[model samples]
Target: MTVWQDDVARDLVRNVGDRLALLTRGEGSHVWDGDDKRHLDFLAGIAVNSLGHAHPVFVEAIAKQAATLAHVSNYFATPPQLALAARLKRLAGAGIDGRVYFSNSGAEANEAAFKLARLHGIGRNGVAARPRILALENGFHGRTIGSLALTAKKAMREPFEPMPAGVEHIPATIEALEAAIDDRVAAIVVEPIQGEAGVVELPEGYLAAARSLTLKHGALLIVDEIQTGAGRTGAWFGFNHEGITPDAITLAKGIGGGFPIGALVTFGVASSLFTPGSHGSTFGGNPLGTAVANAVLAEIEDAGLVENAARRGAQLREVIERIESPLITGVRGRGLLIGIVLSSPIANAVVAAAQERGLIVNAANPETIRIAPALTIGDAEIAEFETLFTAALADVQASLAASETEKATAP
Candidate 1:
């Protein structure tokens, strides 16, 4: 009758408070918690589960690869690793002959990209003492030391000071971008869509401007597509939508479909910058991770999930926007990545209410709730979310009204 309460007993890193739910298993777009309660998952493992949980294809791919070969050191090569790398490069486009470097997470991907940028700076100009790195303010790359240095969040960065050096943050504006980029700069990194900044969509032509500025300054432009990559943005790559190519691109999150994998894809001279001894990942580009990535990408392609995400995402936004609730201000993002801007800072309250109603969502910020479910989610599921989200907002607002009334009466 009872399952483990998961009392935060492990003495794990205490960033957030106690656990919300101990999820037992997941299938399709739904998950069952320890209590056996089913909930529609819209967060999708923070955009990691591209194909939903325990997807049969992904599961089989992992199992088969595990039987054949799960891992091999960077000293060796496997068919899956080579194939997946080639596939990713093709998806990256054919304009540049690119090479792929794999890692275990988005942070690692960004870290590799960072190293490549530094090497690129050294290789290209050969005059600067040290190349400075630039990233958009509020744009999240990852949490590792090198990647963290590039991230723009002060609170996340301040706890661990003196990050990797030569890194600077700038506002996501053309003017700031124009001012910051120069020959001495190694790279300029930007998330085509700011995921952690409440799924904030970047302004149109921003990427184009970044590419232009970086090119003019002879700096490498690195687009961190960790969140927006793998069909999440209704394209193979978010940068693809803009029609401009960056010198380098970082990927992870959805690429492995719940499996831990990351990659740095670089084109042109940047691709050849990393010589034999420059960089390496022991567990990176292993057989198992690449196998799953190929399978996940296959499913995304065969099932038309990318187009589905675009379709359902539009409907999801439209249905919620049509609610015209006073609590909701607007919806922003592309494809399945969505952010509902709340009029008040009641996003956490809204998340709780939605969870109680059998729909799982995330209060991405004080006033924003993010919806990033599986790309395979259909219209029916989208309709359900609309109903649940509207009700959750209503409930939170009504509770706020009641609390204010009680306060007034007490005074």
Candidate 2:
């Protein structure tokens, strides 16, 4: 007799040790557990499901591509790869006569950008010592060696050190930028909004300062848009909202809709930096993935999903603010990448409560709840979220109050 596969997976796999639910089905902004309980899916597979769960168009696109041509080696070119590259270039905007290096995850995208900065240094001053890369204090890149080095969360990185060196952190301040960035730097990488740091927005003038200072010191500016790209932030890219284009931008998460794909898009002088022998990825831009990505892009444009993201995001935020839940102190995000700040350090408890109430949400930090729903979610779904979320908050707060009373009366 064979044990169930789900039980085997739990015992065998090495993971981060936090498993919320075993989701078996998804449609629109909702998912179901193995027990057949339903959940409103605000997490959206950590911002990967662009069109929501099991959209007919997205399903057909994947199925058609898989039937036709699923994958091929990187040495060959596919029509979807070529077309997706062109689409990304055009959407990246006017000044960048750019090129793309596709990969399988956000970390790989940053790895490509990391190497680009080093190769750039070698090209500039043969066997050079300009070996510095600067990232932000709370920024989250990825789990790979190179990207982990760039990520600022020390606890995630301490076990892996001595990591790929020559990387440093800059405080999120204009003064820190003014002081730390100098000629010795090779490249400076940042997230336009630090997603892992509770969806924290970069203070005003910080990105513009990075752009200007990198220009002054001949350092490359690399932007990580992994969690914020592909209409997740309402605009085509977060940098577009901030009005600063970096030398290169890293992408993933929403680019392939629900599939796994990542890309490093470089602009102007940085476009041709990665020549032959500089980089490669076997599963990158495979036929099926790129075809799905192309379909996602078309759906975003043709259906005005980007505009929908803007409008719905505005509506969600407005309603949440108006609720004025005592537990909630403030709400912040652009487009659909929202973070709800709690009045206390109870985000993890809130996550559990929210799930119990049939809503899916996440704790970006101890005091912040993250919401990255599908771009295709409509008014009906948003209303459901508002109702469920309010119940969850009230439940948690009441539990906390009861706990305090019990403690007060305890001998």
Query: Model 2: number of clashes?
Result: 0
TM-score (C-alpha, index-matched) for candidate 1: 0.96
Ten residues in a row with the worst lDDT in model 2?
1-10
Model 2 per-residue lDDT tens digits across residues 324-388: 57899998888999999999899999999999999999999999999999999898999999999
Give stretches of model 2 more than 4 Å off: 1-10, 94-96, 123-125
Against the hidden true structure, what lDDT does model 2 obtain? 0.89
Q: Which residue pairs collide, candidate 1? A: none
